[model samples]
Structure formats: C-alpha cells, structure tokens
Target: MLDAGADYLLAAKANQPGLMGEIERFFADAPANLTSTVTEVDKGHGRVEERRVTVSTQIDWLSGDRRFPGEYRFPSIATIVKVQAQVYEKSRQSSQVRFYISSRSMTALQFAEAIRGHWAIENSLHWVLDVTFNEDAARSRTGHGPANMAVVRHFAINMVRSHNDKRSIKLRRNKAGRNPQYMAEIIRA
Candidate 1:
C-alpha cells in the first residue's frame, strides 16, 4: 500500500513468527525513552475495559541487511505498536496483548483508535453474518468452498441490505427464500 501512497496498520500474528518475536523482544527490552504510550478506559456492555497502547519508531535495525540471508524485511514500516487490554466483567477479569506494524507515524492515541475502529467494523460484520446467515455453522470446508460461500453470503447480505424493507436481515432472508418475487426484488435492488 505504501507504493500506492496509502498507509496501513496490520497485525503481527503467529504466521510471521520472526516478526512477532522481534516485536515482542523489542518491547520487552527497549528503553522507556524509545517508546510512546497512551491509556484509555471504557465502560459498557456490563464490562469495564482498559487499553494501554505503546508505540516505537526506532525500526531501522528491523529492516537492516544484517539478518539471515533470506529473511524478509517489512518495507516502509514507520512504527510498531503494542496494545494491552484488561477487561473486568461481572465476576471475572482477563487481559491480552496484541502487536501491530504501521506504515504511518502516529501518536499512541491514534493507533488505539485505529485498532478499535477496525475491530468494531469487523465484529459488526461477523455478528451480522453469524446471526442472519448462520455463517458460523456453515459446513463448507472443502477446497475453495468456504471462500466461495463467504463471497455469496456477503453478496446476499449486501442485496438484502439494499432492499427497502423494515424487517430484520434474518426476516428479509427468510422472505426471500419463500417468495420468488421478493427474491427478485432483492436481486434487482
């Protein structure tokens, strides 16, 4: 995306073991002066949550040529972020830490907001898909079948959302299943 003049923040998950390890070690060993941090608290949905976001811009060594011969380098990485969240529910509490790499230089607050916003949209879409289409229970696990079905589900969701109806998505989907005219209208929409 940097080649296209766009910046991105992406999770550094286990799939990138080397990258993840490097980030973890950096946060664990780096001096306080090398990082910027921000904290936020939110209360809702019967839970109180606190998020601490830390960011570092000293990544020149990460992309240096001194690594193993074929190791990949993250190009244009301007910042690395660590987000640690603590949540307190009615009778239980939990904590988790996540890491991300960003192409843009941003304040810790901006990173926190960007991460939360991304998850909010992701959770909303997944919740709707699971509730309205029973996507979680789908059995399409063969090669390419799961991906193909996901595309179909997303198309159906968009079509239903476009149709002028006061009913919920589940109800609209049921109506479309039972009524050919309604299905046609949804398709047209």
Candidate 2:
C-alpha cells in the first residue's frame, strides 16, 4: 500500500509460509529482541477473556535479508506483534496465539486497541445483520439479488436505529412492517 500512500498493519498467516515461519521464529526468540507487553481482561456473555499483546521493533535483519523465498521480502515491515488470547467458561480455559507484521510504529497497547476497534465495527455490523435482520437465512443468491437485498437491509437497519424509541431494532423493524404510520414515522426520522 505504500504506492497508494497508505500505511498498513496486517496479520500474518500460513498463506505466506516462509514469512509466517520467520515471524514465528522471531517470537520464539522474543527474549533477545526489544519487546513490550500489555494485557487486558474482559468479562461478558458468560465468559471471561484475557488478551496479552507483545510487540518488538528489533527486526533490523529484514532490511536486506532474503530469508523468505520468492517475492516474499516485505521491506517496510517495522514491528512484529503477537497476541495471546485466553478464555474461561464454566471453569474451563483455553488459549490461542496470533501474529502480525506492521509498518507503523505503535505501542503494544495502541496496537491492541487498533485491532479491537477494527473487530468492534465488524462484530457490530454482523450482529445487527444476523440478529436484527436474519440476514444469514436469506437465500437470494440469484444474480444481483443478494447484493441488492444487502443494501436494502442496511438502509432499513439505519432507518430503524436512527429513531428515538428505546425499543430494540428487531422490534422497531417488526413495527415498521406491520404499522403504516410507524413506518412513515421511521422514514421521516
């Protein structure tokens, strides 16, 4: 994205096997690198989650290193980040780990916040579409019907959410479909 004058902080996965292996090795040797750590705990939805984020900017070897095969050299990479997520439910616990490479120099806490902010928008939109609109059950995949219906669903959701009523979005949507006056009020709002 440097050609587009945009900075990126992207997660690394096995799709790029060499790069992912190198990053994993780097994290395995995090003690030698200049690394920082941050942690956050959240409790909700009958579960408790603990997230630990670690970041390092000591990857000077990548400046001209040809460790990765083919065109896998990412010169703009400035930091390596590792996130460990632990979850507890009904007295049982599990954990997972993920890694990322970033062009922007940010603290572990800032990186964690940025990641969480991105997921918040994604989760909120998915929740609204699935729970409030039953979008997952839609079978309008013929031609442009699915895309068209998605746009209409988004518009309806926005209209319902913009009203001043304290009722849920699903309730408001039901009222709008049943009552013409309420639908008119929602449209005007």
Candidate 3:
C-alpha cells in the first residue's frame, strides 16, 4: 500500500459498502459539470459491459483524513471516473471505470488521461505478478518465510527493472546468477 502519495483513485466495490455508499451520496449531491467521462471495455470472465457516466459536476467528497488526495496539497482539484467490467464463472460480464482527481484544474479529457495512467500501473505491476510471478499462489503461511521471500522477490524485481541495459530482466538475472562478470556488470551498471 506504500505509494508515492498522489491522489487516490479508489475502486468502489461491495467489499467496502460503507465507503461506496458515502461516495455515492457525495456524488449525488455535488455540483453539476464538476467531472464528466465516457467509457467502454470487455473484462473479467467472458462478458462485456459498456457504460458512460458524466458526473454532472464535482462535489466535495473529501472528509476527515480519508479525503481524495491525502493532504499532500496539490494545486488544481477535480475527480473523474469511468467504469468497465466483466464477470464470468456462474455468468459473464465486463466493466471498466476511469477516474481522475487533481489539485490543479483539469478538463474532462485530461482527467480521463490521468485516470487511465493511474490505473494502468495496477495492470502492469500487480496483475503481472499475479499471472507471471504466481504471487497470489504463494502459500508459505508457515511463518516469516512468506514475508521474507516476498521481500527478496520484490528486491530482485526492482533491481532488474531498474537496470538500464537493453537485456530483458529474466536474462539479466540468469546472467547474474551464472556468471560473476555479468553479475558485476549488472550490479555496477
């Protein structure tokens, strides 16, 4: 959950019913034309659902400490969200949501881009780990092993990703493991 402390673009789900309810109520009462958006997507199990939502406007949803931006103090202010998703298993459906918030004023289109960029990191990092690294499959619930292994993996992944060479991280790590010279080059580079 450690992040660079940018504006939070949270996904509304049933898991947090109270929070979702609060957001809904806030949006219902916010000013018109504050935020706006359109979205389309096919995701999840095997269904596609397209939805467009134009927040008549932006409203004051920030309350206490859980406000939109964590009080870092940005200049402009706006939040936009577009959702697309799909659900399979017993049934099939997909949906996607685009959201944006800023301390500096921004147009709807700019908001769309910002929101998209914000969420794509999840697709690139967390999703990749779940699929390629089998992160969620780790079942070492015995003790510190799980936590320790997770730390090592995160460190290794960060090291390889931080490399400037054109070589793929997988190859870079393999080289580092097999050849001392290559390892030195990687570590020193």
Q: What's the lDDT for all of these models? A: 0.93, 0.88, 0.55
In candidate 1, list every pair of residues with a backbone clash.
Answer: none
TM-scores for candidates 1 onward, in order: 0.93, 0.72, 0.57
List pairs with backbone clashes in candidate 2.
none
User: Tens digits of per-residue lDDT for model 2 on 72-180?
Assistant: 7665888888999999999799998888888888999999998889789989998999998899999998999999999999998998999999999999999989999
lDDT of 3 by residue, 102-180 (tens): 3434554555555557657767877755654578888888879988988877776777677787876667777778998
Predicted candidate 1 versus true structure: per-residue lDDT over 1-189, tens digit per residue: 778899989999988888889999999999999999999999999999999999999988787765585476677889999999999999999999999999899999999999999999999999999999999999988999999999999999999999999999999999999999999999988
Model 2 per-residue lDDT at 30: 69
Clash count per candidate: 0, 0, 30
Candidate 2 residue 143 Cα shift, in angstroms, is 7.3
Candidate 3: count of backbone clashes, pairs at least 3 residues apart or interchain: 30
Candidate 3 minimal-lDDT segment of 10 residues: 69-78
Q: Which parts of model 2 have CA positions greater than 4 angstroms off?
A: 1-7, 14-19, 44-46, 59-76, 140-152
The alpha-carbon root-mean-square deviation between model 1 and the true structure, to one decimal in Å, is 1.6
